[model samples]
Target: MSAQIKNGTILLAEPFMLDPNFKRSTVLVVEHNPEGSLGFIMNRRVNMRVDALAKEFPEFDAPVYFGGPVGTDTVHYLHRKGDLLEGSDEVMEGIFWGGNYEKLRFLIDQKLITPYDIRFFVGYSGWSDSQLQEELEGGSWVTARMDPNYLFKSDPEKLWSQVMENKGDTFSVIASMREEPSYN
Candidate 1:
């Protein structure tokens, strides 16, 4: 595995990847170790809200996202409230993943955590030992530095292309290609 790829790294699926679950997806690495790697697909938003997933969840407008193809029965979260949310693991400088669930609900109830301050996800992207290394070596993914704004300030709809373009050089050109090109 490249030293650059680690916890909090951003993995951009190669533009032509064929996997339905990851094609054009922007993934945020939450953990990477000798055992394996795990991340959340940052760009695959689902047409639902967090409140719809559980009866106990407070009524909120936070959109739910398809984190990846693994653990569909689970729910996870990323937030910018590292200072205020207890038990949050910092994925990067200003981004935190997972925290006290009851505290989260309480914060939401008090309007202390806004939808813009957090994102809810279902499932997660994961790889077995050396699986992610093999995938990275095979050119299936491109790495980028994580920026908190990408999650809290930017639009998920354009995250893949936006990150690709930000990489500059050949990546900028790749970012400009149409998702489905037609050669006439």
Candidate 2:
């Protein structure tokens, strides 16, 4: 992987990826190290809401996303509320990952956290040490700089193409290709 591909970087799965878990997905790398890499797929929304998945969670209407194929029973979150949410690790200048869950509920109950301010995930994408680097070298993924807006303001259905186009150059062309080639 390029040196620039690290924490807070965005990983766009190559346009033609065949893996059911990641095909056409855009992922946000929240942690990267020599040990391993951890991220959430930014574009795969689940058909359920936060309250529907967790009985203890406050009755907020935030849609949950299919984070990845690993640890599917766990819950995670990314948000723009670092300033007000305690224990939030800054993934980038304005984005945060994982914070106090009780506090999160309180904030939601208090009407302080809007659905637009946060995203919930049911699992994460992980790569063993050097695994992601190998994938990059093999053309399974492409890197893009993370924009806070991509998480909070963009539509999940269009995030992959949106980020690809924003990457410019050849990537912009890649963004326009059909998800699956016609083969005609």
Candidate 3:
């Protein structure tokens, strides 16, 4: 396995990942390095409403996403406005992650940023340095470069299947299979 995963890519877990949190999950790899990896689950949608968060933070406005199983209470965000803010890091081409509450508030108040332009996530996927590398070697994930269009997709419910289908013939077949293949 490569020591580092190319940034701004998708990590699709193999069907064998029995962990309910990750089974058939699609993750956006925002950071991958010797220090471990961090990403947000792109497929899972929380039941919470954006207005609820907007009321709570008042300063920030963005739709929340299900990051992963870890740090469920923590909030994170991904945006294309990396260059406009301090402390933001690019995870892939045209995609950036991190939070600057003050800057976010300013952007929101000025109407410079909106929920449509960014995604908020609760918690994040984390791997101990070297742990992700091992998983890669074990075939737990298949990596693909990121697509900006997918990041801001309006319909996340189909995003996972869409991504897997784009992986070419092999994954297309898998994507077409029914979730309960045994019944077929």
What is the C-alpha local distance difference test score of each model? 0.92, 0.92, 0.78
Estimate, for each residue in 1-184, the C-alpha lDDT of model 3 and write its tens digit. Answer: 5724857768888755788888778899887777878889987878775557654455544557789989987888888888877788888778888868778767767878877778888889989888888888989888776788887864687777788888888988776666665754
Q: Supply candidate 2's per-residue lDDT for 149.
A: 91
Report the lDDT of model 1 for residue 145.
90
List of clashing residue pairs for candidate 1: none
TM-scores of the candidates are 0.96, 0.96, 0.88
**Where is the poorest 10-residue window by lDDT in model 3?**
54-63
Give the winner by TM-score: 1 or 3.
Answer: 1
Rank ordering of all candidates by lDDT, starting from the highest: 2, 1, 3
Tens-place lDDT per residue, model 1, 1-184, is 5646789899999888999999999999999888999999999999999999967988899999999999999999999998989999998888999999899999999999999999989999999998888898899999999899998888899999999999999999999888875631
Error of 3 at 113 (Å): 0.5
- Which runs of model 2 end up more than 4 angstroms from their true locations? 1-3
In candidate 3, position 2 carries an lDDT of 70
Which portions of model 1 show Cα errors greater than 4 Å? Answer: 1-3
Sort by TM-score, top down from the best: 2, 1, 3
